[model samples]
Target: MQTTKKSSGWHLRDVIMLTLIAIFFGFIFWIWAFAYDAVAATPLKPFANDITLGAWIMAGPLAGYLLRKAGASFLGEFLAAFAEMIIGSQWGVSTLLSGLIQGIGGELGFALTGYKKWNSFSLVLSTLTSTIVTFGYDLYASGYTSYSLGMLITLFIIRFLSIGFFGGVLVAAITKLIDKSGILNR
Candidate 1:
């Protein structure tokens, strides 16, 4: 008799869970827009977006950590962007492109782990990749290329810190809470 390993494909439950995550984060992203605008109006306008970017991309890493599956991060981030768009985000359709880029960045961390480790290291890596990927995107898309090298460095540092805090620290906390609540076992 031949023995075969069980496939780890996504089920309906996973879909529902991912959807809920996307919706929740989508709403959060929508509200975050106002906060972004407020920050932009300050003297720190140039770095405001970088400082607040981590919160915007949290859904991807959060979903990847929770789901522990390939493509979860991408789907989570993309769907959240979709939901944010549906909620009438100020960025309009451009949000979708951001989501796609962010999702790929978020997914790269787990991909580096071969979809095996979903711990602090992976989360940190996610933050790093997200910062790099998003910053790269902004170089042309958001006109970061026009900035001085010093300003670029400053933006990168701020972006990494922001992503590290929200996508790494906060995500670990949320996952820990979920684990403690025994929700996944149900």
Candidate 2:
């Protein structure tokens, strides 16, 4: 009989899987930080900054899909951010905070499903959720609220598209690839 890890909370396999996912994204996030800085320095910074936001949101859903549990996404994203900090992320401790918030955003989607559903709809919802929380955080933490309403709207749209594509669609594709390996089936 195949036991459900959801009702049992997390198993060792779940933890291991989440950890591996987190660690991988930690490195990616660390590298992405530099890319973000490079883009910020370019003339396109005004329009491109939000475009880069999605890269930060991937670990949560990827981990959640693999683990299929309530806190998997949050823990994965948190650990990933922790790794990014240890990897010398430019934002230092703030990166950790961002992870926490972003993880919550990812968690929110699954939570809305009452921890029952793990489908494409949930993934899209997860992307939208992360975009809202992270962008909402940025408004105050990053002083985006001081910007003009038009700029804020533009950033909002860009951030949504970025997360929708990179965090949502890209993560889904990666998850499908991993799923095809039958690792979860085993």
Candidate 3:
């Protein structure tokens, strides 16, 4: 039986792959954050709250699967937040904090699975984990408990969709694409 050191499993290629993916997603996250904030500030905000929770949920699993490491989700999200800051996020340091918590939530899902597996089921599980953690954070951070149960539930459902579809399905698809490219052939 060959035992592998946890961090030792990460090779130069792994770091590079994770770094590139983090930068890419971080850039996207910055753009998304800016657009979301802009739209949220508009009078049409109520009608424009279209992007669901599932989308956010998807990022963690997507990152975890692609990097196939316990820290990948965390690193990826942090990178995204860093990217947001570099791109001039109005939230400034707050975005970094949110990303840290959110990434930890997502990372926990895969970590619970022992980081020895990567699959659609794991991704879905990751989404669910992130949703619970992030939504709790929102409830406290944003004072969302003041909202009605129906509205809260609605938000939860949408968040699940966002995380599941975007983080789970989308991450899976991206990882598959990378695999096809033979970039991370391990």
Candidate 4:
């Protein structure tokens, strides 16, 4: 009988898989951020920062599902941010800070479950956590708090869509895909 190690909660293969996922997120964020800046003044303005929240919804819960661990989401997000910084993100040093906070927000969902289990429901919860945290980040970092009530409402709606669509649906789909691969089988 092969026994899992106690000290190392992960294997080399697990690290490799999570690292690739993290890198994928870094690319996704970079492209999405640039697209936001380009089209913010246009008719697609609502789609601007909204995608930022969506990205977390997709990446965070998916990481948790893939690794089935407590810290995997956070580790993946942090790796993604590190990759972004190394790859020359336009957000500069602040990207690292945002990644840290955002990762923690996403990780909260998995943490709430005590890292014992995850499902589509848990993915939704994780996405919601990411949305709330990122929204707060926007209020302070992006100065959204200075905006009017209507704008705030609009922001909230966008965040809801981001989390619901990306975290709930997208992550669920991806998790199913990974599970079907049997790569995570213990």
**Highest lDDT model number:** 1
Off by over 4 Å in 4: 1-7, 41-47
Q: Which ten residues in a row have the lowest lDDT in candidate 1?
A: 1-10
Pitting candidate 2 against candidate 3, the one with the higher lDDT is 2
lDDT of 1 by residue, 48-122 (tens): 889999998899999998888888898899999999999999999999999999999998988988988988999
State, as a TM-score between 0 and 1, how close model 3 is to the true structure: 0.82
**TM-score of model 1 (CA atoms):** 0.94
Taking all chains together, each candidate's TM-score versus the true structure is 0.94, 0.92, 0.82, 0.86
Query: What are the per-residue Cα lDDT tens digits for candidate 3 across 1-186?
Result: 011246677788876766676667667776676576776888746423334444434455666777676687777776666666777776788778877777888888888889987887777778888888888898877677888999788777877776777787777888889788996664
Which candidate would rank higher by lDDT, 2 or 4? Answer: 2
Candidate 1 Cα errors over 4 Å, as ranges: 1-8
User: Judged by lDDT against the true structure, how good is candidate 4?
Assistant: 0.76
Off by over 4 Å in 2: 1-8
Q: lDDT scores for all predictions?
A: 0.90, 0.85, 0.71, 0.76
Q: Rank the candidates by TM-score, best first.
A: 1, 2, 4, 3
C-alpha RMSD between model 4 and the true structure = 4.4
lDDT ranking of the models: 1, 2, 4, 3
What is the lDDT, from 0 to 100, of the residue 63 in candidate 1?
91
Best by TM-score: 1
